[model samples]
Target: MTDAHEDHWAAPVAAAALDARVRVPGSKSITNRAYVLAALAGAPTRVRVPLDSRDTRLMLGALASLGARSEETADGFLVHPLGAGGSSHGEPVEVTLGNAGTVARFTPALAALGDSPVLFDGDEAIRRRPIGPLLTALRRLGVRIDDGAGPGRGAPPFTVHGDGGVRGGTVELDSSASSQFLSALLLAGPAFDRGVTVRLVGDAPPSEPHIAMTLDMLHRFGATVEREGAEFHVAPAKLSCPEYVVEPDLSTAAPFVAAAVAAGGTVRVTGWPSTTTQPGDWLRGFLPALGASVRLDEDGLVVTGGSSIPGVDLDLHEVGELTPVVAALLCFADGPSVISGVAHLRGHETDRITALATELSALGADVAETDDGLRITPAPLHGGVFHTYDDHRLVMAAAVLGLRVPGIYVENPATVGKTFPAFVETWTGMLGTGR
Candidate 1:
C-alpha cells in the first residue's frame, strides 16, 4: 500500500483473513453533546475520553465563541461554563461548522443565550443540509433567528440574535427531517427561563434512538426530564457540571466490523458498552443476519464472517448511520438486499441514498434507489474509483469493499478526519499492513 497523493488512496488488498483487535476513538455524538451540555451547565465540567475529531473540535470552537472556556487535558477536555444566563456582549461571533451536522444543529439554540448575534455557517455541504426545523423550533421558543440565505432555503448561512437569554416554553415541530432537530432543542432547553416542553405533532422522527441518547445525557447532567410518548417536559433546572466519560463510537466501528464479515475472519473491538443508547449497537443483530457469527465475550463484541453472505430486508430507521456499511456488504452478497425506513439519509453529509447508488453502480453492482431506501442485487464488481463525496461513512464503506475487490481507489480518503481521524491507519493495521 502507498499514497498516490494526498487526496487519493489506493485501497490495500487483504494479505490474509483479518484477525486483529482494533479500538476506535470516543463517540462523536456523545462528545458533541457533552460539549453542549457542559457549556450550558452552571459549574465547571470535565469531559473524559471525548472524541478528538473535526466535528467535536468544531463544537468546542463554537462553545468557545460563545464565551465558554475549554482546556485540553491528556484524556479529554475541561470545560468552564458561563453560568445559567451566559452572554457574549461583543461583536457577532463567526461559527464555522465545517460540514458537521451536529455542530450546526445543536449550537444555534445554545448561541441564542449570548448577548450578541451569532452568525452560523459552514462548508458547501452544510449549506445544503436542512436547519429549518431547528431554527423554526428556536423561533417558537422566542429566540430571534434570521436565515441569511432567505426563506424556502431551509439551510445554513444564518444568524441567531440573542437578547441576553431566551423565554423557553412548550414547542411543537416535525422532526422527521432529522432527529438532531429535537436533540438540539432539548440540549439547550434547560438554560431557558421556563425550560422546554417539546411535542412531536407530525410523522414520527427517524432515528428515535438518538433522541433517547439526548434525553439520557440530559438526565445524566441532572436535568429533570418527563416523557410521555411523543411529549417531553423538561423543568427549568440548573445542571451541575460533573466529570463525564464518553464511550467508544459504535458508528465508527461499523466499517471495521463490516471488514471482518466481508473478508472471512474474526474481529473484536474493545470498549463495547454493556448498556448504552448508541443505536449502532444494533450491529449485534445486523451482522449475524448477514451470515456472521456475533458474540459478546470478555474481549468485546466479536464477529466472525461465514463463507457465504446472505441478503435480507432491513428497516434501518433506528440505526440509519449503519446503512453505508450494510450497503457495502450487500454488494458481494448472493442475492438481492432491501434496506428501508431511511429516507432521512437524503440530508446527511451528502445525499447518501443517491451517493451510494452512484458509487456502487460505478463498481458494476446493480443498485436501485428506492423511495425510502435502497435495493441491491449482487453483480460482478470490478475495481473502480469509489467517490466518497467528502463523507466519513462513504469513505469507510468504500474501504470495506476494497477488502475483497482489488484496485478500488477512494477519492478524498482524508474525509474520515471528521470522525475517525485514524481510520486508515487502524484499518490497514488490522489487516497487518502497518509500518
Candidate 2:
C-alpha cells in the first residue's frame, strides 16, 4: 500500500520509527504569545526552545516591527524589551506571516499599539481565511483596521492603523470567526495602557483550548487574567520571563495515532513533560476512546493502534484544533461518527467541515457536513489525488487518509509547514519507510 505522492517528499534520511525520543518544538500558539508579551514588556527575557516555524517567524517579525530586539542566545532566544508604552514608527513593515493564526491575531494588536500601520498578510491560502471578528473587535476597541485594502472582503492584503495608539475598554465579539480573536486581544493586552475585558458573543466560541493556551502564556508572562464563563478579564499587566520551553504538540501526535489505528501497530512518542500545559493533552482521554491503546509512561506517550475506533460522537467545542485529526480517524471507525462542537471550523484556514468532507469524499469516504460540524460513515477508500485546500491540518490529516487508503497522492506537500514543519518526514519514519 503506497501513495505516489509519498514519492514527492524527499524521504527523511534517518527514516526509522520516528521512534526517537525527540521533543517537538515549542507550541507555536504559546511561542507566539510568549514572544509578543516579552517584546511588549521589554524586560530581560530568556525564551527557551522558541519555535522556528512560519507562524512563529511572523510573530517574531511583528515584534521587530514594534521595535523589540530579539537575538539568538546560547540556550534559546533572548528578547530585549521595548518596555512599557513602547511605540514604533517606520516604513510600512510588510509582515509575511505564513498562515500562523496566532500571528495574524496578535500582530494586529501589536500594530495598534505602535500607531504604526502595517501591511500584514500571509500564505495565499491563509489570506482567504476570515479575520472579521478580530477586526470588528479591534475597531470597537478603538483601533482602525482596513480589511478591504486587500483584494478580498474581510480578508487579507489588509492594513492596520491605530490613531494615537489604542484606548482599551470593554469590547464584545462574535468570535465564532476564530479563537485567535480572544488570543489576539489577550496577547496584545499588555501593549495597551488599560487592559481589556472581553465578553465573547455567541454560544459557539470555537477552540477554547487554544484560547486557554493564550491565557496560560498571559499568566506566565506575569499578567493576571480571570475567566468566568464566556468572559475574560485582564487588568493592566506585563510579561516577564527568565526561561520558557515549548511543550510537545499533541496535534502533531494525532495523525500518527490515526496511522497506528489504520495499520494495527504500536508506537511510542517521547519528550513530553507530564506537567505539560498544552491543550492537546486532552487527547489522552479522547484518542483512547477512539480505540488506540493509550498509556503515559516515564519517557512519554505510548499508543497501540487496533482495527476499529469506537465511533463515539464527541464534542470538540473545547478543543477544536484536534477536529481534523479526529475527523480522519472517524474514516476508519466501526460505525457512524459525528464530530460536533466546532462549526466555527468553516472560517479556519479553510472551511474544515466542508474541506474534510470534500477531500475525504474524493478518497471515497462517506461523509456529510453540518453548519457546526460533520459526520463520517465507515466506507471504502481508493487511491486518488486529494486536495488539501491549502489548509495545513487538512493536508496532514488527509495524508493519514492517504496512507490508509494506499495509492494516495498529495499535491503541494509543502503545505504541512504551517504547524507541523516536519510532518511528512516524521510520519514516514514512524511507518518504517525511508521515503
CA shift of 126, model 2, Å: 3.2
* Stretch of 10 with least lDDT, candidate 2: 10-19
Best by lDDT: 1
lDDT of 2 by residue, 1-435 (tens): 233455343222222223333345566777777787787664767788766776676777767766676888775687767533244554465667677677777777777666567888877866767787788888888887777745236667788875546778789987776777888887777656688889988865666677777888788878889889888888877567877776767777767655666556666667656765566788777677767788888888777776577777888887787888778878888899888888777767778888888878887889899867888897988866667767778766776775556556766667777677887766666666422
Candidate 1 residue 393 Cα shift, in angstroms, is: 0.4
What lDDT does each candidate get? 0.88, 0.72
lDDT of 1: 0.88
TM-score of 1: 0.96
Writing each residue's lDDT as its tens digit, candidate 1 over 71-162 gives 99989999988643344555788898999999999988877887788888889999998888778888889998888545535677888887
Give TM per candidate. 0.96, 0.89
RMSD of 1: 1.9
